[model samples]
Target: MATIDLTGTDFEQTVNDNEIVLVDFWAEWCGPCKQFAPTYSAVSEKHEDIVFAKVDTEDQQQLAAAASIRSIPTIMAFKDGHLVFNEAGALPPQALESLIEQLKELDVEKALRESGQSE
Candidate 1:
């Protein structure tokens, strides 16, 4: 799937509607953000089941601030309505792929139990 542009208006609903959402907070001027774009898009195409979304920090400053995005190219992954991964920086292709693989293998129920959160 192609990466969808997310704004403050649709961000919450989009994340809630999708089971697995990968949000990329980025700015066009950031070199690292540009570097990560292809890797992110490539991975998105490979993972049709996941919702790959991008927030242009320059345009969506409110959304980025709400998410506490202090750096460009911040990638956040959410699974089962919980934040599974959040990191700032451009991840290598292999690292991004590994992150997706790890997310796929996660046991949501067990994680909830471990966190002492009842479903």
Candidate 2:
């Protein structure tokens, strides 16, 4: 499964309503994004449990701005309508895979509650 093209209109519905969503924010002119595309696609194919989406920064400026994406190849993972991970950089296949595996083990709601308590 390659990355799904997400636009401003469908972004909320796709990410919020979905169980787990991994969004890759990128642009055609970005070299690192181009370099990371293949790895992203490969991982998407392997991770059947997650919904992989891509937003073209050039095309979806509104969505990019709303997400506060200042850099290309920003990857974000969302679960249960909450952001679990937000990182800017092009990751190698192995690192991306490892990160996703770690995310799978995390209980986001519990973590959020604990953090809120600490705050």
Which of the numbered candidates is closest to the native, going by highest lDDT?
A: 1
Clash pairs, candidate 1, are none
Q: Give all TM-scores, in the order shown.
A: 0.94, 0.94
TM-score of 2: 0.94
1-94 per-residue lDDT for model 2 (tens digits): 6679999999999988877899999999999999999999999999998899999999999999999999989999997778889999999999
After best superposition, candidate 2 residue 94: deviation in angstroms?
Answer: 1.2
Q: Which RMSD values do the candidates have, in order?
A: 1.1, 1.9
Model 2 clash pairs?
A: none
Backbone clashes in each candidate structure, one number apiece?
0, 0
Q: How far does residue 37 in candidate 2 sit from its true spot (Å)?
A: 0.2
